[model samples]
Target: MLSQSELLQFSRHIILPEIDIQGQEAIKSSHVLIIGLGGLGSPAAMYLAAAGVGEMTVVDNDLVETSNLQRQIIHQTNTVGKSKTESARAAIESLSPYTKVNTISEKASREVLGQFNSSNLTLALDCTDNFESRFLINEWSVANQIPLVSATAVAFSGQLAVFNRKQEDACYHCLYSNMDLPEGDCTDQGILSPVVGTMGSLQATEALKLILELEQPNGSFLLKYESLKTTFQKFKVPKDPNCSVCS
Candidate 1:
């Protein structure tokens, strides 16, 4: 049950038949783990925390750089030289003090992935730009039988997908077959600010949907967008028969 203040704070959601007080409670009880604090992670964290997701754990070792101001909108000029996780935490704290923001001021690796337990985490979001962290999150998601949402944006395009271990859908490795692509960071290849914002917001929406249990969206669905238009396409993301990790 919501207090008068909570009911009023979430009146818009309470009015929705799909998200009544009960659903809002679900949101208030869910715990989300977000990897990376750059482009995709920024908006995703902002919206989820503001929407009252009970807890958020953000991991990132990098520090805020002046160049990051373009697409990494979470950091301010004064926040430069600060750890990305710290900067992100301050933003979440201000927007939704109700939501607990756990800051991992270090980069996420296979070693640190154990910090997230199945019991502790309700969902995981991969907003990391690199392939290694992305694969690590996917492997951990499968091993722990947790759901993972991942989004990527470079240049003018972006892709979003949900990997559900409970349902045994295609993990991130299965979709791309393997992570053998050339390394490219936003520093080298510029990304449009709006593109990052759009994809990150969608990631938050999918995370909320999973937390609320409103509907099990197609895990295989992919939203590919460019500057001109956006399209949601559904197709099979089959599990790799010879997958080393999640087979």
Candidate 2:
């Protein structure tokens, strides 16, 4: 049940015809697990928590290095040596105290991911940079019949998609077919700060739409954006039958 303060805090969302008290309450009861604490995860975590997500679990093995200050907005110079997960937690706490934040300061491996139960986690966000971790999360999410919202950003571009195992929707592996990525992360190939922020913010928006069960129609979809232009392209993503992970 939402308190009077919660209702007041989310009054703007409640005022929307599509999202009233019920939708805000739904958001307050959802638990989302996010992988990675870098460029993409930073904005996604902050927005989701600020929007009143009930619980958020952030998984990242990296620390706040000086080099990451350019695009990793969640961490500050004072936290250069601190773990990314801890820094993300502190940022969320300041925004919304009602939202619970969980930190996993270790790399997300198959073994580590196996510890999470689908019943406890309503959704999983793939903000990891590597293809291995991304595919692993996709496989685990599909195997557990959970929903996975994945996003990738690098070099002034990004991709976002939603996969649901329960509905037999295409998983991340279905979209990529394999775990082989051509290039490395932003550290190797530089990324614009606004590009990463744009992708991360959209990922958070998708999570909120799913949690609130918004009226808008959403299927296997892909959104691509480039920094060169203000326009974004959207396409209907079909499941790849040859996908080893989902098919």
Candidate 3:
């Protein structure tokens, strides 16, 4: 049950027909795992906390660097050199003290992810930058039948996708099977600040929809953003029948 203070804090959310009191309650009961604390994770974590997700476990071994301030908005100038997980946790707590924030100041190793199965995790958000981390998170999500919302942004381009392990959803490996493909990084490719912000915000949006059981993106569709052209495109991502992870 929402307290009087919580009701007032989330009055806007409770007013929505799709996200009434019941939905707000679900949001307050859900546990979301956020893997990464870089450009994408920053906004995603902030918004999820702001939306009242009851428990959030953020995983990241990296530290805030001065270069990250341009896009990693969750960390401040004073937080540079501090662990990203700590910095992000502080930011989330500042936004919503009611939301419980847990920090894992380490890489999302298989052992770390193995501990969070579907029984405990409500959803997993892949905000990591590299393909390896994305693949590992996808594998864990598929194995445990947990819904996964993944997003990436680099070089003015961003991509967002939702993989519903409960349904006939396409897993990440279905779309990118070739692990050898070059992975883009902000340091090398130069990403626009708002591009990641847009993607991260969308990731949080999809997560809320999933938690609320609202109209969510079909698992087979991929949303791509091109900042240069200011265009958003949606394409069907067919499931690979032989996908090792989801098959």
Candidate with maximal TM-score: 3
Candidate 2 residue lDDT tens string, 135-246? 7898899888877888988887888887756455677777777545568778788999989988889889988888877753445778888778777898877777777777
Question: Which segments of model 3 are wrong by more than 4 Å?
Answer: 178-182
lDDT scores of the candidates, listed in order: 0.85, 0.85, 0.91
lDDT of 1 by residue, 26-46 (tens): 999999999988999999999
lDDT of 1 at 148: 87
Screening candidate 1 with a backbone cut-off below 3 angstroms (N, C-alpha, C), the clashing residue pairs are none
Give the worst 10-residue stretch by lDDT in candidate 2.
212-221
Q: State the displacement of the C-alpha of residue 174, model 3, in Å, after optimal TM-score superposition.
A: 0.6
Q: Between candidates 2 and 3, name the one with more favorable lDDT.
A: 3
TM-score of each: 0.93, 0.94, 0.97
Q: Number of the top candidate by lDDT?
A: 3
**TM accuracy, model 2:** 0.94
Ranking by lDDT: 3, 2, 1
Comparing 2 with 3 on TM-score, the higher-scoring candidate is: 3
Off by over 4 Å in 1: 178-183, 229-232
